[model samples]
Target: MEKRIVTVQYNYDVAIVGSGVAGLFGACHMDPSLKVLVIAKREPDLTNTSLAQGGIAAVLDTVNDNQEDHIRDTMIAGGYENNPDAVRLLVSRGPADVRELMELGAVFDRNPDGSLNYTLEGGHCRPRIVHHKDSTGSEVQRALLAYVRTLPNVTIWEDSLVALLKKDTCFHLDVIQEHTDLIRHVNARVCLLATGGIGRVYEYTTNSKIATGDGIAFAYRLGARIKNLHYIQFHPTGFANKKDRETFLISESVRGEGGYLLNAEKKRFMQNYDPRQELAPRDVVSHFEMVETKRQNSNDLWLDISYKPADFIRQRFP
Candidate 1:
């Protein structure tokens, strides 16, 4: 742990302590008159948002999908542990948010008729995921970042890390630049810590390198009543590489689009686990993968989509 010695102090109406989609989007939404500072530990683009390959899940097609169905599927996928209110809100308001993203210049795949191309992913009863091919998160972050930069009140500080956070009459943060010993004290009326997950703590994860749970730790130390720390989603398909701590995710859309998961003998085994098989919720699929590993006495597994036409696969994922 480093000592918090504040050398300089600055004030802002709002301070956002991560430059992911949440931080950027929030900055874009804030009142234009308020001074806002966004602190990024690394380059603003290097975040879990940039690494997300799966698309946003929303009930965009009301005729084919409804909020009730979306909520039910979300509850079932979360094993009913998810907050019902939050789930409902997400299903109801999510489509509008997706539309807003489009208005902000974040493009998604569109059908020939010009409507958004909604695709299916695991745990979804319908094809409600609107995306920019496979790199939806990057497109979202790009749009948000561009829009936020245009906001005169918002200041983005890249390569800066928030080392300490303490709240007195307002929130105080100790921000230190990367590869530098100087710490600058920053005070804000509102501090939003949008730092991402704890995946780096795991031996192997598809999460970005910055997903080390910094915001959660800061909140915990400040006596924030954190919930669902034990509830972690394990992605089922990662490139089988033991050498790197960061593993490339084989996106859920792969399985959603008729890809097959195979055992060591190249035999499909998901049929033995669940009726939905590859389309099962991530946790379910991950659990059965481990079970299959134990039973087969090997960790060897494969996701095969070679049977699909090359042109179709390229167009779909490109």
Candidate 2:
């Protein structure tokens, strides 16, 4: 018989499963003295964060937009059923976090005068979205990953799958190293689960492969109370690719920057539905699209922005 004992070499101060935006950002806030390990089930780039294209909605321009307005918009979008305290916290702290990302080399567009250019998204009273072209999520991920790499206290393991988690005095994670099929027992004083969305549950969704809601499932198994699991949201405009089961997202930022949505008749019809027109929030747009598509008896719709200047569209959306 072979005797086996789990070694102490796998210990860490903190263990983060999933390398999405939340995981990476949370790791950035930890003390440099603490030993931290970030585990990605696949390559670090394979995350829902990279698939986000619509950009962060932060009250960056305080003169034109206030925290209260942003909070109100969010509440309205949620039909006033949102947690007021949580919404307030997110609205207050989000801008500073986004600004921190800028300092860490995340870039966004600037006007000719060189001030941060803001765009109006649906449900927003003012232009408050800051983005790096159409690839805002990718830009933020690139910057944060690079900054995390520079931290001496953090270790990143890619292609590492966290199979199971159990709680003792501290948390023990069963991590499987891919390709080699070797298993290691890693212990952490604190554990954070940042696994992204659960879009794979649907056949048509604009979610990445890594978004299987594994974190939520793990937490539920550990007796954590799960709320709002029923409140799943959908993106309005995903690229109509029949060959790809996973639809590519057409960012709402395009509509924010003045893209128009047309019905099968080739006539712009969003204004007839909502006064905000193309600038309506995602839930509103998506819900109405379903209703109207059935009413009109067609699955086809067209989105055109040709009326806007070509130079402007290329520069803003590119």
Candidate 3:
């Protein structure tokens, strides 16, 4: 771990310690004159952003959707526990952020008229999610990565791990190089951690190998306030395959597009509890599934969309 390449030191105006959508996009939007460094603990493609199958939720179309509706829906989905300021900011700025994402070369699914296509999801009052089929996150990440690559002031370091962080006058990070097994100390005016969620702690999760609470741990160590760590959002319909802990997530859009939630007995469980049936917010569905699974003494839950036409599934998810 103490292997050395050189004693040379480097400094940057900003250091982003994750190459996900947030870090890449943040770097893309930074001042071109400022020195920025983006670090990824593994291959750049291993982020949870690249694993997202569902689309982004925002009011991209005012003709059918509005900010108030989006905000209300988001707050309701969060059980009204979301920070008001954060929700306000997200609902207000999310559309522009998405448009900027498009201007940076993101290609989203479109309707026959060539307008951006929108889809419904749990807790959404309108079909406001703009996606690139089922690979929306990967598509957005690809575009941001391309845009950031063209910026001359930004440097990307993949396979670099932020081992520890210390702040005196500026933020100092001890980065471990995976290939060389050497430590590099990076000093920056600001350090941004978009290292993603802690989903890997769960026995079954759709998170990537990198989502091991690293960012939160670092933030807590640095005296940053960590709130809502207990508020984990679980998807109800992860494919319950055998042995593999890294469960594959069937997109939420399936239920949003009218799928059915069934128990081991092949009974529709959600309609009895909510008027929305399978289209409740993910957390609500997860809780319901948990209760039902425990009550039934089984783990065989399923999501079936086979009622839809075969060609439609291929076209919609292809």
Tens digits of lDDT, candidate 3, 265-310: 9998887778877888988888889888888899889888999999
Cα lDDT tens digits for candidate 2, 1-318 = 754444234999999998878889988999999999999989997888998887889998888889999999999988898999999999999999989999989998888899988887888988898888888999989999999999999999999888889887999998878776367789899999999889978888899877888888889988999998888889889889988878998888888877888877887778778887887778889878887788789878777888899898888777
**TM-scores, all models, native as reference:** 0.97, 0.95, 0.96
RMSD of 2: 2.6
| Model 2 vs. true fold: TM | 0.95
Candidate 1 per-residue C-alpha lDDT over 162-240 given as tens digits, one digit per residue, 9 for 90 to 100: 8899998999998888776678789999999899889889888999988999999999999999998898887899898
Candidates 1 and 2: which is better by TM-score?
Answer: 1
Q: Count the backbone clashes (under 3 Å) in each candidate.
A: 0, 1, 0
Task: Give me the runs in candidate 1 sitting further than 4 Å from their true place.
Answer: 1-6
The RMSD of every model to the true structure, in order and in angstroms, is 2.2, 2.6, 1.6
The best-first sequence of candidates by lDDT reads 1, 3, 2
Error of 3 at 121 (Å): 0.2
Give the TM-score comparing model 3 with the true structure, all chains together.
0.96
lDDT of 1: 0.90
